[model samples]
Target: MIRKTFAAIALCAVISSCKNERRYDRIENAKWLIGRWENDSRAGKLVEEWSTFNDSMIIGSGMFVTGTDTVFSEDLWLEQHGDSLSYFAKVYGQNNSRKVEFKMTSSTKDQMVFENPTHDFPNKIVYRHVQDSLIADVSGVSKGQPKTEHFAMKKK
Candidate 1:
């Protein structure tokens, strides 16, 4: 009976450790996003700022400015819950100003992707870091047509 008990305890320990490792890996993989980025164009200037909220959370803000007028803005959050990572965005003047949650579908050393298929648009959001630039892409079906937007920004 004692031998069986020890085996059970060891198995539990291994399971718990694996869970923690997964969570840690996700948090570590996204740490590179904690910085300011910007993109300038004749249409407007886009800026995104990110900071560490805690060991398991990162907070961000983004906006677009055109000729001193702010056109778009949003609050963003990347958080780890248990062994899962999620991205949340609350865009001003959209969806009653409520936050949308997207589950992390894939992550790598320089890229992370999130998805929410139920959302009306932008069912997928992807972020990739390459050299000195950050690329963001959002895509989904809008009004029965597939659409995608891409934003490329330099570190600021």
Candidate 2:
């Protein structure tokens, strides 16, 4: 009798885990972003062109026009991890690069937002998914200062 009882409990545990299964369906449409995007607006401008085959390796050029004297150039890479999305980028001359990892927090037909926590500046990095759309917004102060920037992307 005790053996049967233990077997039932084990089966229930397995069933519960299966019920909470998740998939990477969000990446199905992400192919639209795999190509390139360009934006040249007064508010913000950017150029990102690349080819990501199978989401394995990605190579691209990125440009950001912020202040009158600041023109930032960088590279981009996208990686797939089960149900999560990730990106790696490098500044033109910065010794260290940045890796952004976050699951698809929220998404819609025309909009999507991915979030990640940070310990450096602001605690949140929100990415907007859209054509000719903004990608990230930086809003945090290091030490009694202001730090905010907006990133936009558009298909070229």
Candidate 3:
């Protein structure tokens, strides 16, 4: 009887500990990402805009402009789908207008990371808020080699 009681108590303790893990509100945690960010790089002058469209969605856009030409542009969004959230991007001239989606893997007050291993190029995307600057990174393997791109954006 004592052995059974001890086993029951251990199971209860294990369950309670699991329940104590913190649960974060993904959208609320990402509130810091809203705003306009811009930077000048070798690619061109890049401008990224983010805003809250609804309680469950944040919309964003990015463009690279240089010398009277908009070289590239993309639309981005974070939305609650089903019971979870995802990141979506539609590059103006990529994959025939099909939006690529990355499922959010983890998030915190100042950081969010998403991953889609099946994507051809970028399989991971990370966004981080750092001291009035936003740092974004996309990384994956290509041609049997690892590659990454970083965007350092300042709020405007």
Candidate 4:
């Protein structure tokens, strides 16, 4: 009876460890982000475009225009390495050469969330697909106060 009890406890430990492991499907989760998404705001007209480069990678570009002037732009990448997915951004004019990375925390068919607690401005990034529209939200703490920004985008 003691031998059987030990075997059962060992099996339970293994199963519990497996359940605690993180499992991610980065390619499948990123498939919905492909194509162009745009929005017009007081700052300007913002556009984001995403394309699939391979099974494990998606590339993105963003541009902001005000009247006839191009104000801002950035390059982004989503990639899966091993069992984790990371989101990277390289914005022009500010740290353009180095890419800031955010680690993906959760993903579903229509939503994906990433987080980087060490970042100054944006610690969390979330993307959601609702009906025909897509939503992007960024949130973080600024000077011990919480701040969040949301952008509603539509395919173009």
Candidate 5:
């Protein structure tokens, strides 16, 4: 009986550690996003910059500029929370200037998808790394109509 109990406890410990490692690995896999990315188009210049904040978090900033005027900006964060990873965005002049939370629902070696179904718009956000570029997609229902925006940016 004593041996059986000890074996069970050891197995549980190993399983718990593996779960934690997998959670942390999600953040580690996003290390490719730790750089500056930019997209210049007829509409404006979109810029996104990301950096490591700590062992389990990454901080980012995004901006859209037209000519010499700054039109929009936002603060971004990707953080690990226990068994999950979440994405947070605090956009200027939006949601009463409060941060919105999106839980990571799917991930791969070079892609991650976060979703917040309760949000007014952009219930889904996806980030993908391809070659030397990053592609970001945001989509959801707005005004009872579906809308989606795609951004392809090169590492700067």
Candidate 6:
């Protein structure tokens, strides 16, 4: 009789522990994500950035931190789709009203690609993140061609 009672107690404890396990947070509630991310080259030139990601969207803007334009007016839009994030960006130009659309090609733990099929692009954008900095390059493109540059900054 004592053995049966102990088994019942063990089963109840196991079930109680399982019920107490908490689920992970939702994607939108990720606080560690909302911030600025900056990237620089070996020569110390700011290449690109993620300015900020908040309210279920990623904002990337032109980098003109130096010169007279410290805050670029143009920004790209990125948001989550399932486990992947998709981007559709415009020049976000001040008074220019120009726009562009880029769709996702692939994504991994440390890399992502965005492209527009109808637009004239050399190739997909490739990013390598190391520590707090992200490196960017374009594959399947020729020399002297313009590729997407990245410098991600998280919101302080």
Preferred candidate (lDDT higher): 2 or 6: 2
- How well does candidate 3 match the true structure in TM-score terms? 0.80
Q: Which stretches of candidate 6 lie over 4 Å from their true place?
A: 1-34, 39-55, 69-73, 81-84, 92-96, 138-156
Candidate with better TM-score, 3 vs 4: 3
Give me the runs in candidate 4 sitting further than 4 Å from their true place: 1-24
Candidate ranking under lDDT, highest first, comes to 5, 1, 3, 4, 2, 6
Give one clash count per candidate, in the order shown. Answer: 0, 2, 0, 0, 0, 15
Alpha carbon lDDT at 49, candidate 1: 95
Where in model 1 is the C-alpha error above 4 Å?
1-23
Which regions of candidate 3 fall more than 4 Å away from where they truly are?
Answer: 1-24
Local distance difference test, each candidate? 0.93, 0.60, 0.88, 0.87, 0.95, 0.52
- How far in Å is the alpha carbon of 135 misplaced in model 4? 0.4
lDDT of 6 by residue, 61-80 (tens): 54545444454445655676
When 1 and 4 are scored with lDDT, the better candidate is 1
Task: Return model 1's CA RMSD, one decimal.
Answer: 3.7
lDDT for each residue of candidate 1 in 75-103, tens digit (9 for 90 to 100): 99999877789999999789899999999
TM per model? 0.85, 0.55, 0.80, 0.79, 0.86, 0.51
RMSD vs true structure, all candidates: 3.7, 7.3, 7.4, 7.1, 3.6, 7.6
lDDT of 5 by residue, 1-156 (tens): 999999999999999999777867778988999999999999999999999998899999999999999999999999997769999999978999999999999999999999999998899999999999999999999999999999999999
Q: lDDT by residue for model 3 over 1-156, one digit each (tens)? A: 999999999999999777544232566668798999999877689888999998778999988899779989999999875557799999977879989999999888788999999997799999999988999999999898999999899999
> Which scores greater on TM-score, model 3 or model 6?
3
User: Considering only N, C-alpha and C atoms within 3 Å, which residue pairs clash in candidate 1?
Assistant: none
